[model samples]
Target: MRGEVEQLVGILFRTLAEEGYTEAQTALLDTYQSKADTDREELAEELFVEVVTNLSYHLETETEVEVLVTAIEQLLSWFSSLVEAAPVAILAVETDGQIEFWNDGAERVFGWSKSEVHQRPYQDVFAASSDEMEPHLAQLQDGKQLTGLETQHQHKDGSIRDVRIWAAPFRTRHERFEGATFVISDVTEQKQREQRLSVLNRVLRHNIRTDVNIIHGHLNQLAETVDDTTEHLRVMEDRLSNIIQLSDAARHIEQLRDEGEDGLTTIELESVIQERVTRLRKESANATIRTTLAESTAVVAHELLPYALDNILDNALEHNDAETPLVEIAVSTGETAASGQTTVSVADNGPGLPDHEQAVLTSEEETQLNHSSGLGLWLTRWIVRNSSGTLSVNKSTWGGTRIEIRLPTQTS
Candidate 1:
């Protein structure tokens, strides 16, 4: 009798499956197995009633199944098109790091055919780097989702490309690890823009602060010399000169802020440095200026490239304590496993900053209202942050401070 009942339940489940009552059919099978004295006809009637009631509720909530399905299909189709059209690589990998699916975008960005990528280990696509893989693997292992992770991926052509990846784990109804889906976006250009903005912001702030200090010193002198007509005339002349300098500084700051990352255009970095050095030489006739720029070193930045160079040189000269201060400028461009970048170094034969002062320059803390001398460096740091580049201070070859700024070469 039990055997007959089992056979009857199987038949009912098959019938329901054929009628598209997938979930209801599974529920009926579960119920029949749990009940010791199962009545086939009664169980079928109960399942039918429950299925109808549940479907009716869903229909009321959804309005219409056909419409909902159509909308869903359309959305899926649109997403499919978008994934196909995107320029960056995309892949879905199991929690075990096995590739489950690869989109056309993956082929375009990673230079791998679908057959070559599918079911392969995700680590195969990553180049060997000390900082690579560990964080991503840890996140997956911990069952936590990760997003906006910037890393380098090895392409089929033996080149590495910078990519911003977002990953999230997927699960099935049985609560099993389905895998993780990754969306990769090429961010080489964005990174470069950030670097340029950082450098520009730093240069602007440093120049402004330096100009303001000079203005302050002149104002102090004017206040003291105001008693006599001859002294007052001298003070007036000094104030006028300081005002002009301040105005130029303000204009330069505005230009840096306005140009942003999009302002980077192909320009000869050597020429920009040379022009800045020439101007510095004229302005600081007593100071010694030298350059060691690579003749072929080219960079992409706004028309204000000369200004950034000028600010660095100006800082070196203004901060120096030597009788005839020396400023050394060096430029270099090179390719790395990830991308190409240009580095510029401005060093001065002056009193090198103490370790604590160097810390203050790089810290995100706002410059102190009362502290003097380091404000220019603070501003330079800010510009470097905006440009999406890095700024570091170290001992120069001349036993002074060296300010190094590195900017990415590519936009994307």
Candidate 2:
């Protein structure tokens, strides 16, 4: 006697044949046909349960076989086209880390056909660094799904590739553990472009900035001579320095974006702030620069903290038209019931921050109109954000702007 499941499938298959769904149905079955006998049976069992569960309404109502099969065929066709149309590599992996199914996209990507790689160990064929594979394998072993995982893969030609993967664990109809499905996207070109940009930015900010700064220093000394070209040299020097500052801010912004919040670490904030303040005091010798830092105060932040702070302090000093620009830095640290916090406040007796720039600093979104004038405030904002900190600009006691960076402590 035929079982109910088998009988249902038989009736559905005949109706599919009559409705011209045989080709799509055959292609769907062919995927399971490629697996080993045991794996094929398991996959079919899962698929059977899925089909039965989905069409339970039709079965209960004794709906016309033709209607049911047409619905099934449409679903099958959609699945087939979806699998075939995917642009990235797709693989079905078993629990023990063996390859079960490799789509055409996978074959084109990894340079191996399904016939060649079927039933093969996944690690042996698709190579990745142990460091990179460790987390993924652990996740799979725990029957967990992962998405948008960025890692590297070794190619048939012994070349390395940067790839992103979205993977999920599968299960059988009886709730038995099966394997994982993976979609991989190659990102070698994307990674290479970022590298090239990093190199170019470093050259512009470091080497080029260095050469221009030298000229700026010489121009300043020449401006004191009262020569005919002294004023022109001074103007050129000032404008050139502005450009250099923009480059510096841009470099800081790039680092913040590339490294992200996870790159923050613990460091003594007092020393970094003091070192930068001392340098700024010497640079603007006429300006009165004061600092109030707690002893041995530390904060969790990116290594670019000194550079970012310099930009803030530089703006406070440079934008001042006062005869004696007064800029003060106050550093403090404290603890709450949950976490500790550190704050660095830079208050200046200069023209307050521009409304547009303040809007950029406070904005959570980036649009052309609400963007920073250059990169100074934006860089500071990103640096603070990436450090798991907050930035606020408001009126200072000296009738100027006070920029504050508040950083949360890293939990042990």
Candidate 3:
């Protein structure tokens, strides 16, 4: 029993050292190191008796040696509760995708029992997770950690759950690569709220006010003007339809924002451009338009890209003052050869964009004084920015203005 008590005291000393109880560890070591001639057995016995004596005045536990051993075991067991109490799914896996540890939080998040998924592969929790999983493993394989990786995960009932995962390569104390630690948090409701708020803000700010003003202004114009209001009414009709189209485009942008990068598609630039150009020619019969599109020009854009293109073309014609109002459209690759980008250049034989309009598009830091009058160029710039692209303004060789938009080949 004395030997057993000594062994337990040795363990307690080691535990205190490991737990960063520096003062207690120093006191315990000083007992023996200060007197090297003292027998270890006597020294451990002396320390054990001192702890039982001191703890008797503090904690409610018994002073018996056997009670002390039981207390230490309980302390070690209690440490495991931290993992169970965590709010997010906490899981540990092996390099071969074996599930090593799954806490209670993991069970609640994934809806899987410990007995059913103890040694199962980690991929069972994911649903069509290839897009992010490939990059995740590549980073882990190179000993890097990834955070805020939003991906799709499959629940036990086969329903898709939206979650943001934080992962890192797990290793043993000897630096051997094991698997990884995955912390998952569900963000579906949060994302939905964000999307709803964005749509409401847009409706309140731009869409509703513009539609009401256009209707009211047209009504007043016809009431006051007794002369030929046919041409004026005709322009009002186009403006009314444009309001609907742009409002829908703004809603689509909100949808894409909610879906993140997974919602985008590879769009054929030539096809989208040719369709818009055909419509433009029919809309303005007197305006001369030309297009130069290559056979296979492509860009990664969302579905609302045509709305942006049409607005740019409309701006060129509406602002033209030349006798021959000519618009030139060309599509090709940009000079940044490493980045796969499809550049769309639209030039017109007009008075060109004002300096303020040009500054808003090309400036790094814009002030209140550098604002534009209309939303035409702002809408075009917004579309390009949201699609992981860039917009530039330059003088066209056709003696007017040119707006060069460069779109990249990847989604955010």
Candidate 4:
């Protein structure tokens, strides 16, 4: 009797499709046919009635038997198309862990075609051994569903791929656990960006707290020692100013991360250098500023290139102990037009940069032993890197620190 009701439901849908049903009725028919197998007879009848009433179509549940066989052909075709073309990786595994289905998205994400992975062990996709997958497979066999399970998998080239997975166990008509299906999303780039931001936030917070404590201690000392308080007051003022500048640097870092390369534009290196040098000369009237800017040395860089140049220029004069600080700014083009790199060198006749501070910019990472003297250098590095440029520290010919920035020129 239950079989007969299911058969009757299929017949009704086939009849509806043939009768020139409204688009809404056809859509409902498609949904009904896909779910009719597991739907209870009462619920199926309710849905059928709703659709018929909406479309004003009379039910003909005893249609030709042949039409019932192919009633869901369109729905199955649509479902297959959607699965194959989905943006996320989707695959099916057998109870024994063999991959039974591999869709287009899986191929694209994993860099392996269906034919290459078909009938392969499910563990082949993961970076770890079968041991790593045993727990997940065991859960699937227990008829459990896994949602948003984040883990790393193996790419075809042996690179690690961070992914988030959703898995569900599929059962047979007899309610036996057969296997599981998995949907995976590639999140490597997203994960890296998040880690970068997290580390920067942590470091910035730590620096701010530590500096504030130092300033507080200095204030207490100043209150006690009224003798020769002039130098002490000057030191406190310097600390306060550094704290404010750090806040500004934090804001700049946030903007760089949020906006990314959207602000990049082709800029003439000569004009940018001239403008910054002119302003710096006015600000530091006692200092001698000289420039040898290369003409038509255009490069693709951020609009904030001037800000980075200012950091370099300011650091030069600020750290100098000379009676009259001298800064030399020079720009030179690459040797060849094709594949040439434009170079900007800023040299200061100040005491050379400390080895530890230089390591902050040169090293692959920052640590307690090697941290930036200030956020200004780090900010400069960030701007240059995002512009597809490189920054380096070397001793100048004048026996002082020379900071060089190399940037790729715009392609014609």
CA-RMSD of model 2: 10.9
Candidate 1 has a TM-score of 0.41
lDDT of each: 0.68, 0.76, 0.74, 0.80
Task: List candidate 2 segments past 4 Å from native.
Answer: 1-92, 100-120, 128-139, 142-149, 154-160, 166-178, 181-183, 202-229, 246-263, 279-295, 322-328, 332-335, 364-373, 397-399
- Give per-model TM-scores: 0.41, 0.61, 0.51, 0.50
Q: After superposition, how far is residue 77 of candidate 2 from its true place, in Å?
A: 13
Clashing pairs in 3: none
Pick by TM-score: 1 or 2, better one: 2
Ranking by TM-score: 2, 3, 4, 1
Candidate no. 4 TM-score: 0.50
- How well is each residue in 95-183 modelled by candidate 2, as lDDT tens digits? 88789978888877778888988998777777765455656876876778788888789877778888998898787667667888889
Q: lDDT for model 4, please.
A: 0.80
Off by over 4 Å in 4: 1-233
Give candidate 1's error at residue 270 in angstroms.
Answer: 0.4
Clash list (residue pairs), candidate 4: none
Best by TM-score: 2
lDDT of 4 by residue, 188-277 (tens): 999898778868776886788687778778777776777655786778767777887777777777778766788789988888888888
Residue-by-residue lDDT tens digits, candidate 3, 55-91 = 4543445423444566478555654686789988888
Q: RMSD of model 1, in Å?
A: 20.6
